[model samples]
Target chain A: MSKVSDFFAEFVRRNGATISVYLFTAVIFWIAVLIVLPQLYMLDFSFRFNLPPSKIGTEEDVHTLKNYKYLLFGAEGNPNAFNWLHLEVFFRTIWAAVLVTILNLVICYPVAYYMTQVISGGKARIFILCLILPFWINEILRAFAFRILFGLNGPINFALVHLGIVPEPVEFIKADIALYTGLAYAYMLLMIFPLYNAIESLDHNQIDAARDLGSPWWRIHWRVVIPHAKPGIASGCTMVFMLTAGALAAPQILGGPSSLWFTQVIYQWFYTGGNWPQGAAYAFVLLTACIVFVLTMMRIFRVSLGEIAK
Target chain B: MSADVELDHLTIRFGNFVALQDANLRIPAGSFFSFLGPSGCGKTTILRAISGFLDPSEGHVRIGGEDMAGIPPNNRPTALIFQNLALFPLMKVWENIAFGLEVRRVPKAQRRERAQELLELIALPNQGEKLVSELSGGQRQRVAIARALAVEPEVLLLDEPLSALDLKLRQHMRTELRAIQQRVGITFIYITHDQGEALIMSDQIAVMSQGVIQQIGSGPEIYENPKTPFVASFVGENNAFTGRVASADANHAAVETHFGALRGRNSAGLKTGDQAILFVRPEILQLGAGTQGNALKSKVLAKEFEGFASHIHLANSQGERHISFSTSQEEALNISPGEEATVHFSPDRAIALPLGELAHE
Candidate 1:
């Protein structure tokens, strides 16, 4: 028994480093299985008419090009069923998402600029905390609050009527425009913070030098500050654009029936339509689009991923 | 005259604490003026006020005759090379120099040409393409200066720019800076705590302490004739003998101290029965029997041999303490750590100021 135990102890001690590395790698693999694998399997499921669950692990009795075919072209005129696989929906979602991202940047830049640079240091931190405090609450609560205020008999309409700006109460909720407003509110901080961090790090001496040399204030910002702020603007835009592109909640709740989103179609294909393969293909397409956009941005910056590590 | 940059009773306050109380100065242009003091002595504040970085609470800072009340630091016809040097780290040497011109939106070709000319003027013509971070400490200093002067302002503000350099480099740069100031013929207002730098480079030096100007004069004037106790101790190191005045007249005063009655020439500000302190520079004290003027006979307490000078500590048989005197190592006094010696100094060399303890109280 002593011989056996000594042998086992030596074995354990000799290969400890390799054993620990294997253990860590195994844990990481399973974690990826739990989170990211499901996403891939779910995408495959969304792309098929009725993909077998076995396809996640083994390619058994599962395949389809019809979903991509139907998405790219149109669903053949099957007069009995609803024609939801329309390509125009993809274009509209992307267009609205682009608009939302632009709006997010436009609103956040000035606010972040003022917060980071104009306010003194102690108050700047307080202002940042105040902007972020409301975000700790559920996004759903905030979205519903907007719904309450913008509803038909909401305070917004009441205020307009009392102030005598509008002759009648206007319907604002469940509109496409309302969806844009809600997304902007939801993601304003995301776009603002990185920019604030970037612009705050800019040396004040540079600005003073520019003005001392005869440049006006506007020209200082134009010639110096904005150029230096490009990295922040690019990263913030990417964050907002990618996030808004995948956004489903704001469009689902605040959007009217005419404002149906592309993600809803993907959701339906996965849960209700039982078209796993088609949904996976659609998921793959959106993933590819996001990747292409980000890569294109990198190419435009002419800086390698390694160079822009921060 | 470009030399007269005048402050008309400049008073600066941060909320309630007055940083500068009725600070009035007239810095002659085309000459190097230095504000010298210990840290937090309102020297830098006065420099900033003149540069238009701080608005004085109740006075005018005027260059020539124009009021510089609201003119921004950039808008004022002045250039400040900050203590940190503030050379843009991301820019090349020439680019950093041309930043002022670039702010004017000078054409790129012309700005580069002018920057190269400045780089050559500073004797660093080949360093134009190097990043500022790549330069040595002294080189970065030159780049900061070249960058400031590229704008050709009437007055230049240098806030202890050489304090960061090594001693040998700092001494070398003093000559270089003074030469450049002369070459440019711009009013240079330099601030520093190091007395050597101020003494060597400044045409006029103001010795300040605790928000008040203690004394202002040429280097030798401030050194040889420090009016206040603070000025006497601060301008150059000095040993003080504290005692009450035994007798006084218009030309001189006799002080009764632990060291028998030592009579020294009065500095024109004392009365009898008043407590006073006698100031004597160590170098002015000679160490020989033949060098007797105000001969102080005492026993040597300690002796130290510095390469250039020797310090001899002598304990007065009549006083409560010892006195230190320094002399050249070449001319030898044969006094060791425990021997009787008589150190000599002229009566006129001693400056008598009111007792500092009573003044502080």
Candidate 2:
């Protein structure tokens, strides 16, 4: 605690008290208004049986575990039963996030490697420009763009039909393909930049030495490049997995009627079903799952939080 | 295993810029050869060519009498120790040394044993399990060498692997590197810009400048009997005199300079009235001369006192030419700055060559 106080003193001494106070207050406001306060309210709301203002005339709704019980089991004291539908959607969301993260890694590794190591000078600038150009548009617009591209009569279906690869225009929006594609494209820059930063700092001579020592192409990447990129991979995977798991726009626009995402269900509970407690409970569950996943990824990849920051 | 390396009329060009041109060289098997030159001299480029990182635009590279055309660096029977040493930072020392064997599908136990053997060879037997980053610079260098040798290639290429070391350690590694090369008995093609390193370690030295090889010979021969003006001024410090040839002969030439006529050995054959430069090493100049051949009459301008010797700077009587020579402290006692001095050197110690580019200080 004193270390933090000392750091605060030093910061104020350097920046002066007024400016320091402004900066500190700005951070506190940001955390409280945007992050901490909302999560705290949600935590409080999750334990309460929320009732409509018109119905609660004399007494307030009491705190209870009934909302959580309904979420975990189905509707009451039948502990032997499970909310299989809700649980399946939650697990599927996590699985799809993991799959998309892996797919982005596989596709972007070579592109990042080529951009950082193979391309030179102005050409490298050009490559970076192309990667950044699509992201200039707002993310929702990009998701909508993916919707058009994967729609029933979109360019992909048109091309497949024209090439005679498919006899008919495929209903891609009726499946999970559109959602996964939009999510992958949405988080691509987050994956590519970190990977590129790590790979670019690598000494080219190490690759030469590996090859000169008779290492084939694949072994060089497996032993040298990937190990060097472990932190980048971990950070990219963690971010993409969290974002994809909690994603709302892409799934809402691209998912079929049967493909109900966890976030959509949470939204329905709060706004449409008029069950704020259940919505808070479901959101907390997703947050917990994401935190567990981030920790697991860090452990499996053998990367520290500090290294991922690099 | 060792093999002879031959570059047959090699030429490499990047667009209009020629990095290396018509470089033909034959390195005998088991010989430790070096390409010595300043930066941008194409020594590393030639090394890259021989190691199969690059292909010559016009000719062939042969290792052990087998053509290396169309072969990539991995397929070539040569290993290169990069300038940075390039040890894998993420791997254990043993894993780094055994990486080559691992790629070849050598069994785990065999790879471990081989890595251990190489660790012993490099005098770091107990350091096999340490990460490459944990070792000192010299230790890392040795690990790099051992890692390259694990594959047992026919030839080893080193691109100034000692350039990163401190002065003391660089000097120490010179002997260690030479000892390792002798022990391995492989054709070692070392590239360095340091003349001391080349002179101390190589059996043969190729002096390069720009994109061309100026001379190729044993160290002493290249130093003492330089065939060109550039070689004479480059390999070591030498006082040069540029003038028009007054008289010519097969063995000797007399050049008329600002200080009148001076005579020296005509190593680069010159006709009468040809432009030439005379080069004399400082150590060979006789102070307070007994009137030997090719004597110079001048006055001392300044003296730089080194521990064992004093370098006396002098100018001709006309003050149009400058000469400098080293003399022992004992002999330099009476020769202070601004005093008259007579210096002489034998014609055999000086070589006159057709004037060309001289080494820049």
Best by TM-score: 2
Kindly list the per-residue Cα lDDT of model 2 for residues B235-284, writing each as its tens digit.
98888888999998999888887666778888788889999998878888
Candidate 2: list runs displaced more than 4 Å: A54-60, A77-80, B316-322
Instruction: Judge candidate 1 against the unseen true structure and give its global Cα lDDT, from 0 to 1.
Output: 0.79
TM for candidate 2 is 0.96
Q: Which ten residues in a row have the lowest lDDT in candidate 1 chain A?
A: A78-87
For model 1, residues B107-156, the per-residue Cα lDDT tens digits are: 99999999999999899999999998889999999998998899888889
- Backbone clashes in each candidate structure, one number apiece? 21, 0
Report how closely model 1 matches the true complex, as a DockQ value. 0.39
What are the lDDT figures for the candidates, one per model?
A: 0.79, 0.89
Residue B103 error, candidate 2, Å: 1.3
Docking class for model 2 is high
